[model samples]
Target chain A: MNTPGHGQEERTGLGTFADNLRKVPRRFIESMFRTGRPDSDRSRNDFVFSNFFLHVQSVRTHRWSLRWSTTWGLGMVALSSFLIATVTGILLMFYYKPYPEAAYQSIKDIHFVVPTGRFLRNIHRWSANVMVFSVLIHMARVFYTASYRKPREFNWATGMFLLVVTLGLSFTGYLLPWDQLAYWAITIGANIAQSPREVTDPIGLTPHFDPGGLQKLLLLGSDEVGAEALIRFYLLHVMILPIALCGLLGIHFWRIRKDGGLAKPEDADRRLGGPDPEAVPAWTAAPRKTWSLAAVVRGRTPAVGAGAENTVPSMPHLFYAEAAVFMLTFLVCVLLSIVSDAPLKELANPNVPENPAKAPWYFLGLQELVAHSAFAGGVLIPGIIIVGLGLIPYLDREKKGTGEWFGGPGGGKLVAWSAVFGLGTVLALEAIAIRFGWLRQWFPGTPQLLITAINPGTVLTLIYGLYSVYIVRRFNSMRAGALGLFTCFLMGFLVLTVIGTWFRGPNWDFYWSPSQWPGH
Target chain B: MSTHSEPSPGKPSRLDPEAMPRRDFLGIAAASMAAGACGFAALGAAKLPKAAVLPSAAKKFKVTLPESLPSGTPFFPEGRSVVVFKDGDRVFAMSTVCTHLGCIVKPAAMGFDCPCHGSQFAPDGTVLRGPAPKGLPWLSVRSAGGGAILIDEGTVVPPGTKETV
Candidate 1:
């Protein structure tokens, strides 16, 4: 209360001294936080409003936005995983050396000598893996929910950049151990990065400069993975990528605020059909209690329609939930660290290359693409996917069904058809490629560019193009088209990753079972 | 939150207060509990487990290549789980034991193969395929007295005793 200065008039000298003594700690705390006492509601609000860390959060958030069902806390989990990875990565860095000669030994020493060293390293490894997984799921959720509409399009683009940065970080870290897995995986990746040359090098298509080869050179610092490559990758993994991710993440969250927080169904409805004349702003007339957003999202959705705006302060609820999730993630990481060991091989020997060398798992999809035609599979497809993801907001500009799964109307059926069609096409192409080995065998002397373009890539392009056109025509909506294309991309990626990781055995040949791999 | 009255021209004076909302009290209580929990967690984390130490003896070994070994052939010592490769004129000794779980790998079609896991090594001791995190060790191979190859398992040293043909 504002009664503090006047209340001193009634106190005796001794009572005044006691009161003043109590004020000492209060004054100190106030000096530190630059805020009021938290006993009263006014002071409690001030406490959050004045605090630097808490002030980044919105003063209040809509009730529907808080539903665990809606988001599954994926974004938070991804950020949490990043935090764990950063901390554990730093701890592991104490012992890690980024030279080909020393890296593997250093890793071995970490596992054998440093007592919680292996645990910390394992956490870092898992955190990187899970962060990528969580981000993929988060992107799927955002895409399907149609959260990237209108003003949020750029934010979605920022999210795309964040995903790329995440992949970059995961990849650069792969080479820090400098073991066989690290060496060959990165070798294959570097080769894939140069895949565009598969097209440009032949047929006199060379421009003034070669950017693809330049990129590969920059990444490797040479023609191959050696000391220069090791250092370059280490710098990228430890320094550049993390900084980029952090900066992009800041932009991403800030854009969420600028774009009016997370997407909601009613937002889509209102924006799409113009505002309802009868609908009133709910927050201005308060003391009218209703269900929180978290409640209805957990299966207590409003009976009649979307209810009054359910905005709640971030002082406790938002902060608590975030903190709890972070703690839970860290605890889970610790348990996983205790149970598992990160793989570390013997010293790197450049003379001997892994016959079926592969890239890090996340890049396996691209690797699978490169296996067919370096340019089409690696350079062209992946580049298209990344560019396509970035351009989605501009491409799908319709405001209808912006925040509902696959556009919320006849969306379920559209999604089913799209999935079936997309999956079937991808599997069929793969089946043909496996059965005939057309790309490998049929193209005896033809240039790689023509063969790559004709076989499989052409099939993929035709199927996808037809499927997208069908989606738009059948559903008579742009949202349906967007949903279909996205489903195809995601489903294709998953299929390729599965095949590359499990089915392909020795000499990059397809095997039905991993156990069937003919290894020495 | 911006609704604090300033003793304005309204009927109620500063003394007549309205009822407090449940969320305000809940916020204060939750904040305090969170603070206490953080404090305890910090105190607990202050004492980490003891740092681990590496055993010095198992860290290093010395192996001399044998004269009987041919070029590109791995020489397996009678009792030691180590293979020394004599490539042309150069000598490289590698541990036959899988780096993964320490299981001894036999020569397979690729190079060296782990039976426990599907880790395959090339002839020169690098991973051809892996569940293995690393390649086979390229132990220091130097010319030694009477052409005998001395082998070390865990760590590498410059081959003081290299085999001379």
Candidate 2:
């Protein structure tokens, strides 16, 4: 029974034809991906350089890059998810209309009529969630590994821009379904955009210099979310953002290559206190391998003259790892898509608002922040975070640990302490805010500026900032301090997001569960 | 690029005829022309938002009060962002647009409740619970010589102002 092809009776007609037909696909893949068998280093190099997709990657990858624990393949997962979303999203666009009166009906038709349409929409949706989640984790991985050091600083900035684009894509897409969820979420978004009026109005500057009004107009294309807003968001979600992402992604990958293919310790060359280099013979006979032509060109190729001691050809090693991650992402998204349909609620009605209307899950944390003060939560905190995250590589210039998780043992301890402090403070403040209420409750008639300037959100931000400063003073290391501050912000965001998603009921009031919600 | 035009730290100001080089002058001229072109383009772009034509529902409409609408009970007119109340012969209309962010408010047992941020307003359009800086605006109302009354949503009347039949 175990013998290969034991049940097969050698067929002369249709079976032989079927066997040959099966071989056609394998041959096609072979022709596309390989110049020859990848058994030798030269063949593997050919496999990488000759293929269009593989050509973007280096001929060889460092051993550190191959470790599952190093990157967890999160970047690969994000890219895979993005690819899936693009394919399914384009398919969806074939049926979707960008008018207020037609959008909801179109979505319903896609759900009920179009063959495999629900599955396609679900895949697009779940993959979008997967992409956002994986991109976040990838950023965390980069931060923890201190991969955004001197040479990769600009790359890190590029990553921040890409992050914003990702969120923008998600947000604009959120309004497309034109359901209650989509409508209210975008309404909240529009309101958040107008939060600058909270400040401008207080100073009597709104009449002459109304940035908030301008923003809302640009975003919605009118005073409210209507046909114009729908068309504008549709244009952005499908065309502009995706194109911008592709351009930025090109720069990101190019920068990665220029930065010498991911950070590693100085001892990675195996000439210092590190382990002995692999015994495999070199691809080229030079004592120190280099891309001579690339080095002679205008820009410096850092990988050139970097000895290939503990590196292997990327064709099978790195390619296999990347392909495995892609498959995993695809499998997970498909499974989730099959099990759960993407949400499509009642048609959007401006006259009726969903009780406790909430923003998309990713922005729920900011919504929770908005509960304290719209300006502080919606505008100021997000502004600070974007600017802050982008400036991290520049701010934390210490070069002690470049490729280690949590930047080594001491850094891990700092992250733990910071996380605990951040989570504890946020929880306590939320509880107090819920129980005793904020400045508005305690001191009625408080000016909007005072309320906007000082709330739980601002207080938490100030605490985290000062704590980060103190950590820097105590440890005398910018990396350690940056680690602390980043961890704190991350923890706070996670906690607030959870509370906003689950605990807040109608009127944004706290409830233990959905069962406790009024009229539920 | 500006090195030629920069005065050295210890040198006196250059007041000579050739103080600004031809290269610098030409560069400035080209840049200014480009800047002027951009300004004109921006001026044209600014006109895009003002919307030459606006399609909106009639701001003033006649609303007939239902016989079943109890005194002091709010009655919502079809296809309008307004709530009208009648008590005996006195009648008033209030804009349902939430002052916080212009969300349409739903009438509650007590008053109007905003669904956007939970800004509540009293029966007389006074602020009850707020992120709403002010209460809902009272719309101008006038008797139309029949059971019907005209509500002008485009016009804002003083708070508590009412029209008598």
Candidate 3:
């Protein structure tokens, strides 16, 4: 109340009655944001610390964290899209019916009848898509920055699980519309769930121990996608997965705080007791200048004597930056929603399947693998990738260039070459796999187990592994090897996803372009 | 309650309540309580999975072939995933469910084409082109005494097994 700005606001408002009306809003603002305006350093710190929502973040953020190039704000964009999806998804729940008979019709009603329903649904769909894309990019950013190295390793593992949960949420939501696209896509998903049969059946253990059948049953709640599966997916998409995501996200954010904020070059420099050539100029000058009371007494805290040398308060700087990224994400999703209607295909018919029934676009890459060998594509390869990605931080223990993109200097060239090598190898392998068939064609009666173990997915994984080892020996650093390996996997995923989405046609047959598809 | 209990030979000990250590007594009591709680939870959970009402359709269905029906053309029964055909005096039904991944296969010019992963099957339910390790399964069929053919989807007949009509 004593602040000059507060008095000036009171004087500018019309007389006592109008001023009384304005007081209500001012009081509301004051009560919610106790630090008011965040004009001074003290107020800025108090602003973030006093607020429940903003408290998870550090009161003062490293300047690097505020830089658009440092993190690209991809994580914030993902969080924004998720919030949009949750809000819109809840709104959709009011109108959506989960029964098979009513589901498709209700979606039609949502599209054409309910006020703002189409726009809301479109936004939900687009934001979910945005979340998936941004999450992938965010992970790539974290990896390229080498932020997962030590003290932040568990967070990386948690992030991988979060990725799974995200994909799970998206996949489960796909079946809610109950259109041909939804039905067929889920059918493909169910089949993928049952892919272990490729190994089980060949070994004659299917009758005794049928894990794939159990998986399929659990996923669909029956033999196929029907009313039962619809309700199950509805429960998962709207409730279970979201709850899991919230819990994991809480850990993810908290871990970042506990790890002494985002990784920076200064941290490694401080550890090594040498001036990092790449360290921000201010960091070297104010090495012992710390504002935290913990600096006085702490055993092995991540930042026992860390200094806030080149940092800005979270209130106006970081908050405004995050808000900008969030707004940009929302704007992009909104524009996409306005321009393109979310697809609603014909009603689901079990009798007549779509010519080339495909899973959700994100899963199409796995589906492409499934075509080669169901067990390999659907189960084994994805399993290996998940476990491998989770183990990355633990495996690569390099401490130099912690926060620099591509782990500083020569890493850029290494990554670029790795990307080219990855893209070329995948393209060549895909061409070979398509033109000349795999083991099944070469050997008239190749066992399913052999094919499952030695398909294109396995080949790609093996090549990536071997090449990564070579890069390690060549560069004599695990980080360089990781950069090479991660780049290759990224490129391979992109290429496969592209092929699956656009190049593959009816009967899962390959074509140079969609235009060349038969009957197109 | 018995005021005195015997300490049995070859057993660690079983005596009056006063003789039992507090730690062991509490541990045993807590374990039993936990077990009881878990048992009740299991009992409640066991009832959740089994549906009170059965699935809408039955496994076995009846279909009558037309007098002038074509020999080789596939005839799909209503609400069923089986395709039936009559060749001369022999009648047979094959499952439309793809052996590869269980997608309902569509009858095609070559034989049957799976839309999910493109596993193809010959007319006689043999794997022509695969990802499908085996072909579409032939369902057991029997005449229902009135030109009506009864197909048992639950039963998988051998590849060439046909009903004589």
Candidate 4:
């Protein structure tokens, strides 16, 4: 058990060197920033000269304990991803061009001409993927540990935003290569992100407006997969997304400090009236020592006697562990990059039309909606989905549970089972339809299915509404208010995502391409 | 019991004095040990850096001619610069380095590509790209001051400047 400072004994007289330097002159002090006394301890000096990786991770170490280290380890994955992206991105910048025609050609040159250009590109691509995945897993860990309970709700929201932005960063980067895959993938993605109905029907004059106009408008600045799109993607991927991520990440970290560090899994049980009598006090009541207070305002009780009185320091065990994880992830990414180069397709030709154009896998859920009618999956379904997701915190007001796993005696089984059952049924039905070729009728040549008659969306929505009603009745019978409401929102998202994936068939069945190229 | 002697006044009390019981001490120790183990495991899981030193056996190629390329054209002359030429296709040779903090710039129809931060560059090596302060640098060329076309890979001319071969 060598503590962090064990190595420092060998360098005890290091301060004398600084003292001698300080005695040298006021002239030197004026040359640099005029500073008074040099508080130059060995560790303090270590902080200044250490590598960039170590610089960011130089937090105060506490007594030997593992709880803080695990959290640190998880956080390090994201930090490492960011670091790798920065380095690889800088290297790639040396070879990449942002113009439309040159973007793809430049990438090709990097692959074929420049020394190790392929390796650099592959690292950047793989690191981006790794970063996104790590962030997601980190979110999951935080949720399962009940870190988002009470005082940390704001951080939770910020985490959610970061998740979206992370995906956005990845999505925007997809189009920079200006190749066929990048172009079609972006087109499909934008088409899937049709404007909300509310935006189109402000006064409700037209319950349904053609999404084509809005879609085109959104793609206006990026008409072709040329300079405009490349520039847009570049700015978004490097500048905009990074800034947003950094800002939110700062707030997220601050929230952890504000909420009183990380919440243990047992916090959920304690919050939900468990037998733990020694609950910590609310953050406001004992603000300075608490890691985060967002949970307290959300009606969670702090662990009793959990104040800073006997608090352990955040030692190197966790920090070292986190550093290791970061290295491992980087190595894995590099290995993947070297082994597998990302797919590079033919130069982008907007004139050529490809069948079964699809969006990114994440948006497959939304694409599933296009199977029903143009309006259902295309216009109406996506609109509802976004609105619902945006208003999640407001819609689901259950306070009894925290994290993915519920607390209390029965442990959120009711909500969990219902969600599983509902989603399971929809998936099963959709799989059956796809397997049976029942959806073929909705293809381009076939007549469009009746909006209400054969639309899977209509049936799914009706089923969901009925389930909601049943849940409400069941809640009344069981006397569960908040839990019931939470279940409803969760169920709604799961259903929409699953159903959206099912119905959104190839091309979104949008006839724009064919209509424009008549007699082809 | 009646015959028992009284305790001495100077001696310390034999009654329990420590705040924590043996069970509590053992529990805390075990918890601390578990935490320490987790930290160690996490540290152990870190990945190591790959060997990045350039191989000694690698070959090098040199450029011969410094052709006056049009603004938007790419120069992929077999093994030299991989920059794409843009801006109406007359094609001037430009570096693919993104000016905005140096991510390799990709070529798009509108401008140069920045996959890291979306910086755009125009054909004439202008800052059509963002996060970049300036445009890509053009390599200086000389006709070996004689019959040979000698490209000085070391010397770089700023964008928009014309140099003779």
Candidate 5:
């Protein structure tokens, strides 16, 4: 191989030796070990590929501008969670004995003996919380942007499942501390799960055995919150959830390729012939060939026009920006973790009762349901809502397409207003019921009222059912295209209600105990 | 470059048009020389620091002294140490915490080694390797009452100080 500029003869030294070696089947090794000059494309690629921090980024396409931000946001959250898990997990590992007796004491050691142990644990706890928030927000962004439409629908569905798993991961991890807060919170959560089924036989000849009691058995692996529960939760949190998330994430990325980058509404609408094709090219050419799987999947045949060959790949710019955003987000998570450690209450003493047993904030929506009749709010409602959310893709059925591709400004308003009025009415009515003590009639007395009032399961079911009806009606009225806009209000309301309940304090309590049975 | 004088005669003057005025020529020459000198000074300054110390001979050590080194003293040229003293005996030692990436700094002449990224430190623990922000920390030591060496691990003196350890 001739050396450029320095001359062919000049390559007689190490340069020629390297060139000669390149002829051998050691190309993979050469590439693997190669170090390029800084600022060169090769070097930047290497940096992104090899570096741990940068590797998670390196997304391929630039078709969707905001899509990059979404991916970046999600990726940052994941990276931050990983970092927190690593730091806290390692610190925790030092003191965390997997055995039931040792687990609690290990946590104590982490709090007392480890240098900055509390800080590490807090960061891990808070980052886990923030990761859930980010992942949800990322999903919402995808939904609002219509990123889940068409070919990407399966990935979107997978993402939704991942979101649930993420929350589950956070919830399960919370109990590992084994303190009073963790214990009671999980207890309340499990009971809420049992409430609906528990009352099924009340009208029957046999004494009604709470079907919901099964939840306790399943969650705790026994009658009460004890050693078994802690180990079960720990294994789920550390091992199960991470594996599920990793698998889903793989599918999510692959779908991006299969579905074609981010959905551009203009291009999507054009494909369906709802819009003028002359206004833009039939298909938006991906920014770069290298970043796109288009050629491999769709074949190299030219679909639109000639000049498509010259486009630059999206890898260097848009993907780079995504990386920058991820870094920024991770930095924020670290800052938050360092500043706020998750509070751990006094150790669990089963004999003692903390007056207002609270559930995790996410579960507060369900707690709110318990304010209604226990059967309606605690059992039937949440079960229905979870089932409904899981079946959203099948139920909605209208092919709206993905991202910005399904364009139009029609009928969205009617759907939006309908959902706003319907879901909004349920939340408002529930709030009113709790404040005015209207649901007390069903419970018989204070104990009964506490059991029945503000049942989140019921409230969620009612809301989901009503919204589903409104959605179906709106689409039947030819407002299908505007579902995203219509649904936005309900989403906002749910968020507001959750936030409100979180800040509401003691008066909003809903957990039950045998001694504090209704009518007491 | 010669300039011919004008022929003195009634017939014609033959002074070359290219001959510049004496004052203007002198001014231009002086300006050019001044600019040249400035450029040379900048070049010299740029190269001076690197040339002054041979890269191979750069001294780096962790300074741990039983006796207190004053604030301005250079302990190790580029190393860091934790110093402790008992009764009359003074002892100081270096830690291996790498300045970059928070990895444990390893033992080197003046300072430590960063295993994670392969950053080298001078004996005084100044970064001999790229990517590190600063040098190793110097454990300051001072003689307090009762003849005990008061090792002030908290105070870090800047590099290149002239005071003795």
Candidate 6:
């Protein structure tokens, strides 16, 4: 084990055989790994290129990407979180049972009986939450940077799908514990999904003799969340969503290579007019050939004019970035696990329902919206958000601010304005509905369709739409308008979620302060 | 390769960019603070004997309410501390324990109030807001003879019962 100062520096003659042990690994690394030379660029590139596991990363990466703020290392952290989740989830599965009767008891045993099972469950729970959080943050980074430009549109769309898949994973996993908290959370989610009836009722629209029931049917596998729903969620959480997410995540990562590495600033130039592709001169001087190629054989395919400054090989630099993020996530999860517990309430009893039945925190925003109208927050808005986000790369196709955040000069200002407008609108609508409730109260004879359509939720949405259209026309840039509107939407989500998580009391009624809650 | 790409995606690319002080400083600071807080909390928890965390609070609460609770009005017994709603034949009893932070709720005009977080409770044990997951729980109440309404606060029973007059 001797390696100079490291271990057993001087070995006696009989033990000399073991003294040179470090040499065996060094030789193996040189021969097999090719990274024994380490610091040299060639060795670094060879290390990534030769290794099957890391071959997906580029041999070299732009130094700009290494900055933590650029992507916040979210993509790497999310991947690490997912891996941590998978390992812990597997550990939990060994002790958990899918059946309703056994599920709650099993979770109890994991907390109390199994060795370190609580820690494993806590890691799984927190890591799952963190993965979803990081994925959303990653998307926001991509959106703000306008990285989803033209050719990258497909990747952006796939990323949007991945986000939905990530949400699905969380929602499905919510039911496994089978406590009152888990059971009702899923029940509320399932009910919310089924709420197309509320949306359809507004327009006197029948979903082709009720296609509205389809979503509920698909999610619940029955009329209500019960044994069937539990099994269905378990299957999807354990089997379907992970497999789907993994495959799509693979595509999402691979497309980065295809679409070109992380979006660079100059990508903006590619959108608008740029330094004209070095004037191509006709090869009239090529004397002999009928068919001739006068191409200036580029200096290294991807490099051509790519100057070498911040470019570092991904072998160690990026690999280390991924490793660092993973360790950080692990340490944080451990610390959190040690201090807090994943919550569990009484065993699920269908007979006894939670008064202010709620969904998971992530879906609580929609639940808050649902308190006003099941369709708008749960059905329509969420649907539009998913579809709209997917189409964003294609919608605001301006090359000018292709890779720039916010969009242009006043981009940041637009974001603030949009966020304020969005938040103010939600709060104002809630306040108005609470104060007057004119549609539901004063006008009893009015058709529910009219009432639901013009209700506070719908009205505010329309107002925001009009405001954003005005923003677009005023700004003269489609990208600027998109930035404003998207920022507003993000802020609105936080507002609604905060209300749902904290301020709303039983029956989903608004409370101005947490102290005002009727939970005496 | 190309030292120029865009302007480093969103930010202005500059000399000594990765060292662009604020972001890294904030990130490291936040991470350490969170880790430190968690470590402190864990250490605090470990230092305490298990009983300190889960105090053996007297869970059983037996309250005797006056025979008549003005119909539809919330009545707090003078000596006993449970809130009972006795409307006509129906009688429901609720503990004043704020499920959120364990603050005792005092009877208010319309409902109950926990001064600690301003969590409001309806005449029935519904949570209005400060912050907790669920509403106030209803404890079991059955009529005992001789104007004595026996209330058991240990068992959690569902509300909406019809106490036939």
DockQ of each: 0.02, 0.30, 0.34, 0.01, 0.00, 0.02
Better of 2 and 4 by TM-score: 2
lDDT of 2: 0.83
Ranking of predictions according to DockQ: 3, 2, 1, 6, 4, 5
Q: After superposition, how far is residue A449 of candidate 3 from its true place, in Å?
A: 2.4
| Clashes by residue pair, model 3 | none
Query: In model 1 chain A, where is the ten-residue run with the lowest total lDDT?
Result: A294-303
Per-residue lDDT of model 3, residues A138-174, tens digit only: 9999999998988899999999999999999999999
Error of 1 at A164 (Å): 0.7
Candidate 2 residues lying further than 4 Å off, grouped into runs, are A1-39, A50-52, A269-279, A283-306, A408-410, B1-52, B67-71, B87-89, B143-147, B163-165
Clashes of each: 21, 0, 0, 103, 58, 27
In model 6, what is the error at residue A359, expressed in angstroms?
1.5
lDDT of 5 by residue, A197-232 (tens): 434433442234645555556666654567777777
Q: Kindly report the interface RMSD of candidate 6, rounded to 1 decimal.
A: 15.5
- lDDT, candidate 5, at B16: 31
RMSD of each: 16.8, 8.1, 7.5, 22.7, 33.5, 18.8
Off by over 4 Å in 5: A1-29, A33-60, A66-83, A99-101, A203-215, A268-314, A371-379, A395-401, A405-424, A439-464, A467-471, A474-503, A507-520, B1-165
Candidate lDDT values, in order: 0.70, 0.83, 0.83, 0.53, 0.52, 0.69
The candidate scoring highest on DockQ is 3
Point out where model 3 deviates above 4 Å.
Answer: A1-29, A267-306, A408-410, B1-56
Off by over 4 Å in 6: A1-37, A199-208, A267-309, A513-515, B1-165
Instruction: For residue B68, give model 1's deviation from the true position in Å.
Output: 20
